[model samples]
Target: MSALAERWRAARPKVAGLHLDSGACSRPSFAVIDAVAQHMRHEAEVGGYVAAAAAAPALDAGKSAVAALTGMTADDVIYTTGSNHSLDLLLSSWTGPRTVACVPGEYGPNLALMAANGFDVRALPADGSGRLLVDATAAMLAADPPAIVHLTALASHRGIAQPARELAETCRGLDVPLVIDAAQALGHLDCAVGADAVYSSSRKWLAGPRGVGMLAIRPALAQRLRPRLPPADWNLPMTVLQRLEHGETSLAAQVGLSVALGEYLAAGAETMRAALAAVGKLTREALADVDGWRVVEPVGEPTAITTLAPTNGADPQRVRDWLVAERGIVTTHAEVQRAPFELAAPVLRLTPHVDTSAEDLATFRDALADATEEV
Candidate 1:
């Protein structure tokens, strides 16, 4: 077997099921799980503050791992509870009257956050395919530039990878701040789009423990952001990175995320992405012959997420449950609320990871086919 395949196989024992839900949450390697336990043990023995001091290097390494993936300096990485928390910190810290431009299929929670913060949210003009029209977006920026131009590098519910790099360049030309929500793209796809800021959770493609996410901002942009609240400790560093991270955090989860990032990097980004993409394509082809099923893809090239829906009026959640209960296959049901503008009905989001094998994918297709007939 290929080295990458071998590594994936080695990691398989860590997962309890045929996990095809990397888009939602991936199974972390045993090493990552152990790291978390080890940190917790140390904290219990040495006291929380002392243990944190001892783990300073590993904690710093976690930031470096995120920086390595996103092309940012380690100092620019800010740890958060999750993607939504990171975004809330970012938006809440903005001092100016807020105005933001984004795609119609922007993440549901993000839209709500903007509305709650009283920011004027504008949907950028796009082609029928939902990719932002570069010229039109640039025109809008020139006519009345929003305080920030936000883009989700990839949507969770669909297969289209947004044109974030092009939009980033456009925003850069206009000197507008570009914030990229890479919750779905950080570890699954190439994320070095050169946006002013990028943020994502560790639970998804990174396969880290939940409740820990990282945000990276350009040093220049970081300098401009004011802290959301006054510092509780004047002795602590007051850089923009430090400003976003307030209150106590899960040190063990941070260590787990660091180890997870190491595992992903050691496997090599291109190798892992290619492996995942292959499995995703294999799944799509496998299910193509299945009746009453349609693989959803937009104008852009698809990433690792293969969104499928039944045309026979079968409920998507029911289909997901059937797969889990009868077939021992795990999948995610993408709801309309997740992508309010893009999805009219729910879809079965099958995300094949680096560890999935041909046999497993074939079984998934066959089981799905059988389930479609019965339900």
Candidate 2:
């Protein structure tokens, strides 16, 4: 293992078996766990408000870390329960026409959220694989600009990464506000694109605790949002982004997320990204000749997510369950509901992090073959 992978695996000692499900949730480091425990302990001794007050600086640092990752200022970021909540807050706060242009394969929940918010959701031009065609998208935006341009930087169901930076540039040229769902890309891929708003959960690539997410809005967009108002009697001074945040939140989770971000920075972001990409390539290559299943992504797709489809109409969930129960290998089954507009059938999603080894891939391949035979 690489030194960084070694340290990552060491910090996550509970992962006794091969773990290939970082797309769903990563293994939290000891530092993150301790931070949560320490904050909870402090809350037990003191009061919740008091413990939160003491953690203000750490929380601020966490915001700064998020800003650093997303190319925004700390003042532009706000904490939320998770990505869904973050997107809801933004959508609810919108004061303009309810129209959104996004990829056809956008996350199903996001599509539902747009519908609930009464938005006319339109599909951006993309190839058959669901990757945005940059020139075509630019032409489409210029011809009929939507109120908002939303892009999921990386998808949940597949490994094909959208051209977020290219689309961001086009949206900027057209003066259209672009919202990015970086749930699968924040720590795994570079998220420093010039989108007007970016949001993600902390648990996936950052290896933070669950129940914590963040949203960062550019100053121009932040000023335009009509977020919920505080009570008239409570004369609390707050920034526009801060006003969007709920009054009560879990300080323990915030502290854990901060420690996790700190660890990612300390480990070197570029180093981690490269390691993940390498492992993804390794996985695709190793599983190329595995029988009864085929890799869904192109061998050269620069993403840590990989998907496989059974050739013989086998249930992916059964294979996933068998792998875990019999082989101690963890993975996720991506249903068509995750991207109902694009996916034809369910797929087996494998997302290995930097800690994944070649030996792990080999083991997974052999185990998957066995699973295919049995299932």
Candidate 3:
């Protein structure tokens, strides 16, 4: 085992989480939070402008660091409150000549947001495995060619890992612009989606704060994007992401984001991927005998997100509540039938981060066994 994995094992015993919404932070998140606290204390002593100015190097380094993490250029990155907002900025700026297309089973709101913004939304069908048909989606794009094509790197409702880069490449083949929402795939996959635009949340896999996220626009396409409002001085810091316009930003939160991204970078993506893979394997092994619990992802697709739920009416939320109430375990239940982000039904989402452990999964299983009995 690697040093990071060993440290993760040491940290796993601490959570004692029952509901097991372990997917979000794991352990890499701690380093980010510490950096955030340290930076905040230092900034407190200085004037706002002086503070931002003083931290400019860290901020700049942060931009480069995040760019490196995503396999993109520094200039292509734009700071936003989170992936949703980052996407809103991208969606609002659409000045396409004709169509829009998306894959089904993606994060729901993004599809509606595209339609709400007036792009002609088309849903590409998926196979029985819940994976999208990239060729089919690309065909739709080729027909009239959409203003944009989209894929969610990993579906929020279940641990379905979409073939985002595959679709992104397909879109590129058709010369259509693509946007990938990688909110859940950041730490799980080191992907270059080959999209004109991409978005991700810092909180989910990167272990950053709750509010920060990232937007990566290809340089060729970044220059073409217009915010909802007018542009501000580029050097002034993007206050708010206007579809094609610009606005003010959460300076402190952004600083925290940079810190978090740096901490993730320090660990290296390969190390993180290995840790997640290890935990996911352990989870599959631990829950092998549980009859009701259904593991979402197939063995071939590598993902840390594993879901366990009652085979019957067993309300997922009640399960979530029971786990936390009984064992202080934090997790979410999935109801794929609903959407618009917040309204999306909760699923028993279990994400093991770069620091998760076999022991953690075992303890979690024990808690689940207990939770399931009363239900």
Clashing pairs in 1: none
lDDT of each: 0.83, 0.91, 0.67
Choose the strongest candidate by lDDT: 2
Off by over 4 Å in 3: 8-19, 25-31, 231-247, 337-346
Candidate 2 versus the native: TM-score? 0.97
lDDT of 3 by residue, 239-312 (tens): 33324323366556677677767666677778777777666667667776775676656644577777665565
TM-score against truth, every candidate: 0.94, 0.97, 0.87
Clashing residue pairs for model 2? none
Q: lDDT value for candidate 1? A: 0.83
Q: Write the per-residue lDDT of candidate 1 for residues 1-375, one digit (tens) a residue.
A: 467766866874555657889888888888888999999999899898898898889889889988988888898887888999888888887877699999998889998898877889988987775677889989988999999889988888887778888888898898999999999988877888789999999999888999999889998787777775665355555666766785577989988999989888888888787776776677777776677878876313547788887788877888899988997789999999887986688989988777777788778878887777777
Q: After superposition, how far is residue 25 of candidate 2 from its true place, in Å?
A: 0.5
lDDT of 1 at 281: 75
In order of TM-score, best first, we have 2, 1, 3
Assess the local accuracy of residue 263 in candidate 2 as a C-alpha lDDT between 0 and 100: 96
Best-fitting candidate, scored by TM-score = 2
Better of 2 and 3 by lDDT: 2
